[model samples]
Target: MNTGSETQMGIIPPLFCIKCGLEHRLPILIMTAITEQAIQDCMTQIRQKQEPHHSLEIQKYAQLRLMDFAPLLGEWGIDDPKNTPKAKPLPNVAQAFQAAELSAEQKSKLLNYLQQAAKQGSTTAMLYLAYAYAVGKFIAQNPTKAVECARIALKHQDYRAARLLGEMLAFAPALASDVLQNDVQIAAQNWVKTHPKLAQNAEQIPQLITQYLHNPIVAKFVAKQKLQQAKTMGSPIADQRIRGLSMIGVLSSSQPARQYQSIENWLENQLAAAHMPIESDDDMMILPEHMPLMVQEDDDVPVWHKAAIVGGFLLSGAMITLLIIRFLVK
Candidate 1:
C-alpha cells in the first residue's frame, strides 16, 4: 500500500538496490515510478478542487517528482532534475503570497514561517529562502546571503540548491532557465579529473568557479554559450531575451541538454510580470512579446550530432549542385 508519504519519496528496497547489480531494471522502474507519482499528485490536486492554490501545489509535486534520478536523470524527456530535492506543503503565510501584493508585515511573517520551517528540517524552506533572498522576494536582494542559504542546503544534500548556487557563480546571471543547477558542479568534476592538485578538496570548487565569474570577456562567451544552448533546445522565448544578453560567446561551444531547476520560482515570476498591475518593480520582466512559445530544443540530439548537421547540409547541397550541372550538360 502506497501511503501519501510513501508516494512522496520512498527509499528503494535493498532487493532493487543498484549495489546488488539490478542495473537494467533500476532506471526503468525509477522512471516509471516518477511518472506515476507526478500523475497521482496532479489527480489528487484536481479531485480536491483546490482552486486557490492549485498551481502552487502542482508545481511542488512537479519539482518533487524529479529527485535523485541518477540512472534516469539524463534520459528523461524533461530537463534533467539533477538532484532537485522534494518540497513540503506550503504553509498558509506562503500561500497568501499568491496575491498581487502583500503588506510588509505579511511578508515578514512569511519569512519567519519559512525560517522556522527550515530550522525544523525542511530543505525546501531553505531553497525558498535562497530564492527569496536572491530575487528579493520579501527580503532585499543579497547574493551572499542567498549563497549561504543554498550552501547549507547543499551541505545537507538537498541537491535542488545546486542550480541557484551555480547561477551565483555563473560567468554572469541570466533568466532562470538559461543556466543549469549542475553546470558548475559538473564542470568542477571535469576539472578535478584533469587537475587533481588544484582541487584536492571539493570545497575548492567555489574559488575556481569564482575565478570565472570575474572575467568580463569570458562572461560574454559564457553567456553566448548558454544562449546557444537555449536556442538549440528550441526556446523561442529565449530568443527575445537575447536582445539585452551577452552575444560575445558566438564562438563558444554549446552546452549539454538540461532541465530547469526552481520551476515554482520561475512560474511565480512569470505570473507577476504578466498580471501585476503596478509597473515599477525589481524582478526581471518578460514583456508581452516575450510570452511563452512552443519549444523543441531537440532534447534528444547530442552536441556532436548537432555539429555534424552543418556538414551534412553542406554535403547535400554540393551533391544537388553537381546533379544540376550534369543535367545542364546532358
Candidate 2:
C-alpha cells in the first residue's frame, strides 16, 4: 500500500508503548540516567533482532525513550542497519495534516508516510491516522477504523485515544455498543495495571517499564513549565495526562493529539487547566448537563398546588402585618 511519501513498504501496525499507569514524576538527573539505560536496552534488542514483546501498556516507557531520540530516529540514529530512510520522513505528522489538498493521490504520499511511521510505533503517526479515518479527511469516513486505531493506541497507553473514544461514545456515528464498551474496559485495565504507581512509585515499576525513564529528553519533559502546571492541578486525569505527555515524547509534546487537539491541545491544555479546579466540591446541587433534558414529571406540581402555596404565603404575610400593627397600637 505504499504510495511514495515514504519508501515502498508495508505500513506496520503503528503501536505505542503508551502508559496506562498513573505517574512517573522524577527529577532531571534521575530521568537522564533512566533514559540512557533505556536507549542501551532498546538498541540491545534492535541489534539482537528481538522484537519488543512487552504489553502495550508496558511499552509506554519505551515510547518515551524512542521519542527522546526522535531526531536521531528521523535521521540515522536507529535506521535499518541495512538501509537508511529515503528522505528524512516528510511533513512529520503536522505538515501533512495542514495541507489543503483534496485529492487522494495528492495526499497518498503524506498518508502513506504517516502510516509507515505509525506502524513503526510513532505516537503522532498513529494519532494522525485515527483522526484521518475518524473525520474522513483524505480518507473514507470509518468510525470503526477510527475506533480500531484509537483503541490500539490506547492500549499502547495514550490518553488522547481514550479521550477521543470517549467523545465518540457520545458523538461518533455508527459505533456498536461493544466497541464503546471495550474502550472503557481497556482503559480500566490500563489504569489498574499502573494504579500502584499512579502517584507513589518509581523504584517499584519493573525495568521493562522504567528502563527509559531517565533521559535528557525526559528531563526536558518533566521540566516543561506546562508539564509542571499539569501536575500542580492534582487531578487523577491530570496525573494520567502528565504521564501521557512523557510517553508521547518531547518532540510531539509541543504537537497535538486526538485529531491534533488544536495542536495537541490535550497536552497544551495543561497551560489552560491552571485555572481549573482539581475537583468541584460545590454542594449547590447542580445536575449534570448530560442528564435528560425532558421535564421531570415528579417535580412538576399541579396548578392548584402552586396556587395554594402562593395563597398560603400571602395569608402568613397578612397575619404578621396585623400582629405588628396591634403591638404598635398598644
Highest lDDT against the true fold, candidate = 1
**Runs of candidate 1 exceeding 4 Å displacement:** 1-86, 91-94, 167-171, 174-212, 216-330
Q: Write the per-residue lDDT of candidate 2 for residues 1-330, one digit (tens) a residue.
A: 111122111221112223633332222221112233443565466447587453322222233222232222232222232222221233445555566554667688877877888787664566567666655567753444666886666565544444444434322112322233233224433543544333233233222122222222322432343334423432134445446645665223553223222212222232223323344456654434322245656768889999999999999999999999999999
Q: Give model 1's TM-score versus the native structure.
A: 0.32
Q: On residues 33-83, what C-alpha lDDT tens digit does candidate 1 reach at each position? A: 223355466546545654323232233233222222222112111333333
What TM-score do all the candidates reach, one by one? Answer: 0.32, 0.33
**Top candidate (TM-score):** 2
lDDT of 1 at 201: 42
